[model samples]
Target: MGLNKITGILPHENTCADLVPMAYFYDVLKNIQKVEEDIINMTYEDGRQPLLVHLDMLLTIARKYPNTAAMCIYELKRKHLKDTFEAWWERNQKKIPKKYRTGIRQNADELFDELFAIKSWAKSE
Candidate 1:
């Protein structure tokens, strides 16, 4: 999906209630990546072909993180959020596709899980 399509799903910023819902939108993106990686490695087929749903979800997730990160920076301006996010963004820039680089971030926990799974699978085979 395109950036505009996913951003349209974000809640209207008229009420305080929008905060949690917007955050949950990112959470759904995270979960989609989780399942995507699971499917990629577990499905017995051509590895080159990615699931279309996963690709759509990834683009959505990629498109949403900047807003999420910016919100995080605002909420935790006094904390290390800005610096930490910058560092993460810089370090992982190459790993993320160009579409996601502008907005969304890679979910660290999901990345780690995928790495561990790949490692374990490699050892087993």
Candidate 2:
């Protein structure tokens, strides 16, 4: 029923071993925006939400391309989904295989740290 329950059931990173290119992920993120908008505008009959689906996509992406997954987080933050993204990350980080978590954490820290610093600095101006 809840987002956690829905996303908790999805496949883990280890299960997604296919190599996904960065461009493919970029395209997927672009297309997901439309679905996200629709989900935001109307109530879903099946109780599913865009964020839940997006989280699954992100996990798959992270499995193949952790750096690209970091970019997806940037995209989510750009779309004002920071809180949701953070919650999703917290909920699913443990579900990701331990082997992949190091790369994911490194990529996320490298990408988001600078971005967040700049955002904070801009807000102060």
Candidate 3:
């Protein structure tokens, strides 16, 4: 199949708002699954170091679709993805480059705060 045909099966820009609920459900689940797979495949001596590439991917997603990112975070917490991530962080924190560690932790804390705020607002509505 052509690239266009492949992209056609995915949700379109116009339908994204309507797909928010599904995005919330599936995005977090998929991330969790992918992270688990990465952990299993890791062969590093210090264990699976946190994937800065994954973090960068998330930042790109957040920039392009802020609402979807919020929804995904909401689902992540609801589905216990946060716990999984925390466990991963604990396993890999020490292995992260010292220069990048502080910034990564700050960004992660900010993301958690933003997600929690979004979920709280949603519940109050």
In terms of lDDT, the best-performing candidate is: 3
Clashes of each: 1, 0, 0
Misplaced by over 4 Å in model 2 are 1-20, 43-46, 82-125
Better-scoring candidate (TM-score), 1 or 2: 2
True-structure lDDT of candidate 1: 0.40
- TM-score of decoy 2: 0.40
Comparing 1 with 3 on TM-score, the higher-scoring candidate is 3
lDDT of 1 by residue, 44-69 (tens): 23222233344344335334543543
lDDT of 3 by residue, 43-108 (tens): 333634344345445545555556655555543443244555566677778887888888878877
Reference-based lDDT, each prediction: 0.40, 0.50, 0.54
Q: Candidate 1: which pairs clash?
A: 62-104
Which candidate number has the best TM-score? 3
- Candidate 3 steric clashes: 0
Estimate the lDDT of model 2: 0.50
Weakest 10 consecutive residues, lDDT, candidate 1? 115-124
